[model samples]
Target: MSRIDYSVWDHIEVSDDEDATHPNVNTASLFRWRHQARVERTEAFRKKGAELEEALAESKHELTRAHEKAGELAAGSSKARDDIERLKREEREWEEKVAAHRREEKKTPWNADTLCRGGFSKIAVINDVKTESVGEETETFMSFEKRYEKDVKRFAAMRSWDDSEEYLSDNPHLLCAETFNLLMMMCVDLEVLKKRESLEQTAHQAVVMRFISRLAKALKVDPRACFRRFFSKMKAADQRQLDTFADELECFKEEVRSAAKSPAWKAMDEAQRELEKEEERLEVFESLPEEMQRCFDRKDVRMLQEVIGRMEPAEARAHMKRCVKAGFWVPGAKVDGGDDDGGSDKEEDDA
Candidate 1:
């Protein structure tokens, strides 16, 4: 069996591992001082490395620009050739400096703080809604409705991005998957209502949420934690970026309209209209005069005739009209003083 070599471990600088010190010396203070000095040294080395890396990047950029300029100029142009050669030399020098920096970094002995770097990959909830873990129930539209439906509606109604950013900044807890789902549903509802302006505004907000969600995914962070970053980027975005965003907003609006035109949405709209009609009919029925209501309830032609006879002509006409609209009275039905051969009694009050 081969013996493991421990020579690599000799360079680890454990500050507090000193086995001996003067009796009067403050050992704790000494250890702390050593740790602080080591940290300062490491930070200085890292800063130097960063500066070298930046220089190298700048040099490479200049070299690339020079090469492009050289290509554009005449083949025999002396100025472009001179610039390219100078930039190439500078780039090589910067690269050498960067290489030296890396070698120096490797030479720096590892300390207790740097021996083994620790890394963490975790998603933390920023608000009251905790992130669901494996085996936990994920947030859904129904659950979102139960919690944030009203808040989401208020957010959707906001016409300005500035106001929306402020709102989300204040209520970071709402920057979740559920809130996104609600916003999308709101867009669909607004589209179904034929609210073009509101639909566009809500669709824009939904698309913003989607972009934030995507950005968070790309950065491997919680959407709630990084939503403000998205807003900041948007606020500073160039015209091209803004135009792309606008395009996405239009596409999202189209999607909402498409959803609203689906068979399921058509059926829902029809059902909603029927319910509204029924409610209106009930309201008209309730508002009718007691005599007319009784006549309809009893299905008595004579009673209706007597009631209409007692009432003023205009009042009787109004009541009968409401009853007809409410489905209490059928059009063309025979009544007292009217022809019995399937004729309407609508003109009976004239007599």
Candidate 2:
């Protein structure tokens, strides 16, 4: 058998927002047309089969007429016998054609789902409801997504990418959207944290992302499946290749750190500023109870607000004050409907 070429899916880009729509395309109409087309195709098959059955029924009528004609002829006449046999042969042929049509109807139906499943494969059977090496016992989709998100974020903050990879190797279930997105965000955060010396960290991030993407493309499986493959390949690589990666990583870091105006620094050495902000956020985060801390872990402002809402007025005020002071809530971060707009009311409130 020839190998499949899966290159078409290689460069497909996934939108950051799942429900985002293109203004130029009428997605509703497209879906409607597709559904209509599928219905018509299905009906077409049934209609053809119905027509075949009708013809077969007509042939049976002809056979009955021929038998009646034979009965009216002389009992020993060869002509009457030949007529009956000819009608019987025609009836048999019609019956065979109808049977063949029924078999044709049983062939697999084709559509988007078939294409996605790579055609004619069994409808996926979610066996045991549990993975072999990683993850908790099967839970609802929401619960699993949340659990993986938390774990992935926590793992992404590890000191080294290798450490992060190792964690993922152990907890393979985290090698998914939650993990990949958090990994990307982790790269951004590290870049933000390291104004000047982000080269090595960013390099590592890029390498990890590339490894996952390329392996996924090669294997024609989801990126999650290729996590182990990537690590194995890296582990088996030659020492010279390893040394080159390490030396280049360090050199890139040194080069970035040497830059006069790195993005992290914002044109002036703000090492203390970033550190102070991180310390403040952590302080605020640590002060919260576990339930409240969950909102922070998820970066969910509204949930945090709701948690605060249920508190006594004084308690809410105190929590808000601490959050404000710690820089957990940024001065100009956008809220629902709009952004801060840099107004004096916020300053008054802060003051």
Candidate 3:
């Protein structure tokens, strides 16, 4: 006969079931308070786990950089030797930190909510085509969109963490850097077009996507594997972290707005930068005094000089500054005093 196992019931936290309290005390309210406190404690523990993971990731990144730098130095150099020793010591320290954290995590008792959380043994197998690794695929924006656009839209439509989590769990391949980048661009595009409601929903999706990315980076795992953990954390009454995500969304929207109002804030190629610069110059030209604008419009250097000659010194200086900025005035034309052709040539060149 197989042995009956009863240890599975260990550490079961039943907030509603306990010995009766004093008659004057409200049992229901007390149970609610206890549940709240337990949730808060769990949330705090989750936050600490995230923080520790981040620190470990940073430490590993730093150690990798140190090794790369050390490899570039002379093998026998004193500095290289010192760095090697230092790196070894730092590596041991971080390993110890990680080991201690793992121990602590193991010591934490499972409550009713977490008792049946996902584990390797709990994963179900499905007979489906194998999904290609992202690293193996060259996914351009168009290809990524063509493949996952419908899934992304469906995800963006979800407003609840539980729903979003379930959707992503069904479609794990959508959890990737490419999807995050595309979603961010969509949010920015929506903001640019003043689609407030759509932008809000898209921005929400973008923030959640970013959280999954961060979780993956912290744990050194694929983002698709991190989505469940991220959603689980969000569902654990972690209101502060949710508020943080909301703040991130607001900041991202603000950045998009700022970039739309001023293209210089966004990175661009040389041609795009030149185009933006010309557009900016045209705006300045429009703001110039009417006489100055007309002079430039007519390509009349003589008229422009006459207009400047009539203005107060301070006003003329300001107008001249705008003219130079607008590519209408070249300070050093490299022309003979009486050569109109040379001046006109310089004006054409500047324009």
Candidate 4:
């Protein structure tokens, strides 16, 4: 069994309650019966999941062989078209079978022991590309996206379980990101050819990855590792539970898109600095002694002098110093340091 990371429980909304028993029945026996029933249901779901997987595998194998056989038929052969259609039908049937099992299995509560021992974990951003690794200068997110063309193509062309598994096992680092992108691209490619069945399968894989990455981010876990955890939880989810995950994924994706465009997180410069300075000046202006404030407001030089004279010399000087620096008011409306009322009637201090 995989290690149970209770952290996944952080944001979940599931309840665990003891069984309700009739007054005539022993509560302990009722509880035991409920526990056994849950165990049996979980085991059935696990067996069904395994069977669905096996059936899907067999269906895909048949579809592959059908494609090869169809290619050997003449271009205008109705039999070849018929063969292809049959394989496509089988594929859809298998997909539906797995989905139906997933829906049913979801009603049962999670059995930690039944969780897959395998899956993806983290989301990592390669920070500083060394000369030895990338063989180039460091690249931004946009630059890396531009360089991903061939890598995307190679991933999209994956046709078999062995090839895909081997490729992913070897390039586990890129599986969560590049693999997902390539899957979506493959869906588009298939859609262009009017291959809706194949397109659906490809898109499903892409959605699974996208959801896994989102879940990993929420739990602060690695996307690659959490991918399996997601599957484990999902495997036991009924339709309602599955729909909840789908809805949350859609909302989260929309939130990210909206936030990416807004400038709320970016820094500001000149206007912001000026605003801050003005606020600081206002704070200083409010801190002055009441008598000094009246001197500033009335621009009364004689009254200001009277106020200063009443205080300790150093204290009065410090008050005046703050007033001057904040441009609250100058000592006088005058040319000299001591402006008589006769000097200039008005002086404007520039902040």
Candidate 1 has which clashing residue pairs, if any?
A: none
How high is the CA lDDT of each candidate model? 0.74, 0.60, 0.73, 0.59
Cα lDDT, model 2, residue 176: 53
Stretches of candidate 2 exceeding 4 Å from the true structure: 1-149, 157-166, 195-206, 239-351
Tens digit per residue, CA lDDT, model 3, 1-351: 869976656656664546579989998898778878888998997767766676566456555755666677867778877766776787678778778877887667777667776567566578887777765564566588888988998888899988998888898888887787778767766766789999889888888988788778778778876688777767886775566566567767876677656665344434555987899898888888899889888977777767766877667777676667677666666434655544334443444
User: Candidate 2 lDDT, tens digit per residue, 1-351?
Assistant: 769965555443233453455888787886677678777887898767755664565456556756766776778789878867887898798889889988775554445533365455457767666553433422444475566766755664556647867787777776554444445444445555664344344446544654466456544577766576556545778563365455545544444444424565453346646876888788778887776788778987667766765776666667666766775656567766785534422432544
Return the top candidate by TM-score. Answer: 1
Local accuracy of candidate 1 as per-residue lDDT tens digits, 1-351: 769976667787764549589999998998889889888988898767755664565456556756766787889899988888887888888888889888777777777888777675456667786776743544355666778788887887777768889999887777887787778777787877788888777788888888778667645668876677667757887564476577667667777888888999888778867988899988987787787778768877777777777878777777767666667767665555665622225533332
> Model 4 lDDT vs. the true structure?
0.59
Instruction: Give all candidate RMSDs, comma-separated.
Output: 11.8, 31.8, 15.6, 22.4
TM-score of 2: 0.30
Task: Rate residue 323 of model 1 by lDDT.
Answer: 65
- Tens-digit lDDT string for candidate 4 (1-351): 878876544542223653455779898987667668877877787767765665565456556756665676677788878867887897899899989888775554445444444555656689986653342322443354466655655644555434544554555565556556556445544544568666544555466666657666645567765455556556666564376455544443444344434465123234455777899888987888888788768876778767766877667667766776776654444534644543212222211
Model 1 / residue 148 / CA error / Å: 3.0
lDDT of model 2, residue 211: 49
